[model samples]
Target: MSAKALIFYGGWEGHEPEACAAIVEEMLQAEGFDVRSEAGVAVLGEADLARFDLIVPMCTQVSIDQVPLERLCTAIEAGTGLAGFHGGMGDTFRDAPAYQFMAGGQWVAHPGDILDYRVEIAQPQHPLMEGIDDFEYRSEQYFLHVDPGNEVLATTTFDGSHAPWIAGTVMPVVWTRRHGRGRVFYSALGHQASEFTNPQMREILRRGLVWASRTTDSRETGT
Candidate 1:
């Protein structure tokens, strides 16, 4: 059966959330996911939130109601996969520690803002990164507070142009971590939807979503 997936987008329009949502929705549909799209966190509050196999957050810098926040995190813990990219996931739900704990990271700053940088594949032999080579990208190089438990797959180094102290600092640009029974995958790519045009960026997202959505254990647990 096709995996059930929900994508909610809104918050700061500068992130091009709507376009990112549309791009991801199309990607999921093409991958045979039964995709549902919404404009805010409202759908996360649904009584049967656990029904989806995958939950994608495209909303950046938004506040969700307490119950919905708990339900969303609980659903993930119960085996609903969560996958997202860049600020859409990395910089969202600023006030909620639970959300960050579940998602595995939070954006702190992009010292130099948009610029050219190279993404080095940290785990070259990993299946998710198979055939993927380190690539140069021009966008916001995220400096984040990340979960050390995460299996970092890609990294980027800060050159100290914008922030001298952080120069030579290696930061995670892509990672995966488990939250209870769920798989959580994130990539510090996609400042806007157009970044999806890059084959490497597009493929990482495709692989990340597929990897995150296996919820057989959740179904078996009945949680």
Candidate 2:
């Protein structure tokens, strides 16, 4: 059976959660996933969650009640894959450390806000990084407090042009890890749907999503 994916999106409208959800929903559907998209986290539950093979939380900085957040975490621990990008994954629920812990990172700041930056491939041979090259683009250069347990796939060096204190500090831009039996993936990209329009960004994000999915087939269907 095709894998089932649940995308729960809402929170800071500045991140354009709806547009991001549309992009992800289309990608997953094109890849043969049975996709269900929702507007709020409250609709999620442990029982209904069991039907999905993957969960994509596209929420930005918003509060998720403990019960639902706990249920989502429990589902991921039980083997439901989890994946997201930017604030949706990294900067979500600023007060909830557990969510950040499960995501493997938290956005502390975006030095230079929106500007040109290079994404360095840290793991050139990882499946998620396949067919992609270190590239330059303009977006928020997210400075994150990342978990050491993450198997980093890509990184970016802070030139300190905007935040001089962080000059030359390297940060992880993409990573993957395990949450119990579940696979977890995150990218410090996708500030908005437009960010994914870049071929490299789109390719990397799509590959990461496929890699983090619970399905056994990891082939890229060119979504």
Candidate 3:
């Protein structure tokens, strides 16, 4: 049977949740996942969260209720995969520490808002970064509070041009971590669906999803 993947998208329309969901859905479908897409956090409460092999949350600045939030985290801990990009995953569930804890980071600022910046591959030998080189893209340069345990795949250096305090900061742009038995992958890029349309961005996102889904308990996990 094909692996099941659920995409829950809603909240903060400015993030273009629907558009981002569509891009992610199409990509996962092409990869042979049986994909299910939903509009709001309500669906999260309604479903048996553990049924799927992967969950992609395409939301930003949204409130997820306690019950569903607990189930979602539990599901991941028990071995479901979670992956997403930008605010969709990084900035979601403001009040939920479990969500942020598993995601390995939280979106604190963009530094310069939307602008041009370069992404550097930090672990070129990692499968997620394989064949992907340092590239330039225009979008929000996410400044995040990240877990030091994350296996960082790519990063970007802050030039302090936007925020003087953060100048010379090197931030993780893509990373993967294990939350219990689950594999969690995230990228700081993809502020808009159009951003994913870029070949390089799209490839990274797609590969990240595939990597997350295939991950298993053989991978290490910790606090």
The numbered model that scores best in lDDT is 1
Candidate 1 lDDT, 50-111, residue by residue in tens: 88999999889999889999999999999889999999999789999999999899999999
Q: Which 10 consecutive positions of candidate 3 have the poorest summed lDDT?
A: 214-223
Q: Which regions of candidate 2 are displaced past 4 Å?
A: 219-223
TM-score of candidate 1 relative to the true fold = 0.95
lDDT of 2 by residue, 1-223 (tens): 8899999899999899999999999999998899999887776753478678989988888887788888888888998889889999887788998888899989989966899999999978777887688999799999999899999989999998888899999999999888887889898888888888899888888877887787757634211
Per-model CA lDDT versus the true structure: 0.90, 0.86, 0.88
Candidate 2 has an lDDT of 0.86
In the range 52-170, model 3's lDDT, one tens digit per residue, is: 99999988888988899999999999989999999999988878888999899999998778999999999887877778899998999999999999999899999999788888999
Candidate 1 versus truth, CA RMSD in Å, comes to 3.2
Cα lDDT for residue 98, model 2?
Answer: 87
Clashes of each: 0, 0, 1
lDDT of 2 at 45: 55
Compared with the true structure, model 2 gives a TM-score of: 0.95
Error of 2 at 195 (Å): 1.2
Off by over 4 Å in 1: 215-223
| Colliding pairs, model 3 | 160-167
